[model samples]
Target: MENMLQNINSLGLETSLTLDDIPNIDLYMDQVIQLFENNFNDSKRNQEDKILTKTMINNYAKGKLIFPIQNKKYSREHLILMSLIYQLKGALSINDIKVTLSDINQKIINDEIDLDSFYTSYLQLTGQNVIDLKKDMEERVKDVKKEISEAKEEDSGNLEQVLMISSLVHMSNLYRRVAEKLVDELVVDKEGKRQK
Candidate 1:
């Protein structure tokens, strides 16, 4: 009876690995970096892009802005999360977001939470209202610069403030989108897609 049971288990394992049964997996680390590099070249060198530099990336990776999978390589979901984290460089500070993400990941690993629900909660917790804050600030900066140009005020200080605020607003928008998108991509189950 024991040998029969063992044979059945082995058969089950083999069946699970069939091409049709393979899991809907996420993208790997290399793929994620490639995505970043591609975007970096295509985009203009704005304040948003500057924050995605080597120093910031290293800080985020070391700070646990991203979670590491053991034994197995990272999936597309992980890459998406990293990219999202990269976008968030302006708000919440590096350490703050990292700690929040780590706590969330722990809940996931412990099975105390499901990804979809977790994603929803995270979105609520982060507060999407701040995305508008960025947009408003950027618009204000633009308006100010337009006024300055009309007045022909060539004071470098005012010009600098306008540029700085624009950069901040852009970075804020970038980060908000990153966190939101990462959650959206990671939380859905493959079975959910079958219904669609």
Candidate 2:
């Protein structure tokens, strides 16, 4: 079992920007766009895929997904909020993200909480989540292999591939559903307007 775990490499899940990677000084909108593009270039699905755009940033501001900018320059807190928006946009609706981040943004704007310290803690949590995900993937594969243990070598190999794909898909869906549920519960629907 240990050998099997050793030989099988789980998918990489640690891709993210550290606080050190962000500029300490405030940056203009174009500079912010460039930073995100450079940092996320490796994660792009295609050459033409954009990490961030002026229009998108404008829309985020219009939609209140991010805090107001100062003199067309975005602070470190703004960058952090944008980063969170970019990431959560994939799994959650824009409205849901706005609802989720609004309180944090308020705390940041009002100086009620230190955004840097909070982001550091968030980064730590993200790292731990990656570790947990890899461990769960290994266990998922092991369970699939155990189920097909009686098959011949060739048949078992093919069966393992199928089972592994199925297991991974189901696991991903289960996690996504739980995340959505957490979002639903965390954000109270005002005027009965629930977000996706």
Candidate 3:
């Protein structure tokens, strides 16, 4: 065991010590659980609730959402993304969310469309309506499928498709509500004009 540890270390594996390997496994595990639970509750909600449902967590593990960590532990960014998805709980289906996200990620491929900047812009354009958001979304969907097809031909995971998909999904959810509201407003305006 000691030789194996040494060999792993020599290879720069940096073997981690689990609670079981430590002197007080139970106590350590309890502390870890408590800390994780506290963080999970206390962390600020992003634009959306970000608190993931059990199904969401499972889907995340299944590549529906991607994070560097394979375990349940999630980063702040993941939390924010999850919250955004929470906002779209009723408005969009998981499949639609996946499509929208892929589009947003495709937009990010070039420096011209920085997601962070786009998010800020999305928020700033607060009063603007999203009547066309759906149409735009559909177009984006077509584009993403095209991108996926191109990538498939290349036989590549050059960007880790899951990560890109998850990240984009987060962005789409964040702005979806605003888009919905905008669409509603447009409908009302059109109706009013028709009545006039």
Candidate 4:
């Protein structure tokens, strides 16, 4: 169990492209697809899973989750927006993502924030959170191991299963709370008042 935990901890680190990594020149659809594929290839769960697809890109554009293409080409801003959408989609509903990104998109359009600045800040914030989460996971593992050790012999077999389920439920609840807070911050009431 210790060896397994160590191996899991040593798994490849999650990575994101920096602002400098995105091409300055506008990219055609195929180029955009290829870029996303290259970056997100590791995220695929199976051979049948696609990191990004043309249909998904088109759907994002259609759903206003990303900026509309200009002259059949995507700008750096588009790539950044798409990347944000990709990351959030796994944890958020489409409508939630749309609301959050639409707010950001408006800010970009109004020149309130440049894509470079926004993406940089996002990377910094999330990178820090990732570090914190790793520490939290380590602590949780230790706590679970201790709990399992203290369980009655007859109950020992089920302790690990209980811990796994409890951990997943806790994590899901945490995600829900964060998502709700984000929605509260981004979405306005019907009378045009900010909920937060």
TM-score, one value per model: 0.44, 0.80, 0.32, 0.85
Model 3: pairs clashing at backbone N, Cα or C within 3 Å: 50-82, 50-83, 101-168, 101-169, 130-182
Candidate 4, residue 17: lDDT: 63
State residue 106's C-alpha deviation in candidate 4, in Å: 1.8
Clashing pairs in 4: none
lDDT tens digits, residue span 101-194, model 2: 8878778878898888888888899889877866876788778778888554566877787878787788778877887887777665543554
Candidate 2: what lDDT?
A: 0.79
Regions of model 2 farther than 4 Å from truth? 1-12, 149-159, 189-196
Best by lDDT: 2
Candidate 4, residues 96-172, lDDT tens digits: the string is: 88888886787777878777987899999978876776777677777777878887456664677678569868897
TM-score for predicted model 4 compared with the true structure: 0.85
Off by over 4 Å in 3: 1-51, 61-63, 66-72, 105-113, 125-196
Q: Report clash pairs, candidate 2.
A: none
Superposition error at 195 for model 4 (Å): 13
Q: Per-residue lDDT tens digits of candidate 3, residues 73-114?
A: 553333334434544444765655544454343443343455
Candidate lDDT values, in order: 0.51, 0.79, 0.45, 0.77
State in Å the error of residue 37, model 2: 2.2
Specify the highest-TM-score model's number.
4
Ten contiguous residues minimizing lDDT sum, candidate 2: 4-13
Question: Candidate 1 lDDT (Cα, whole model)?
Answer: 0.51
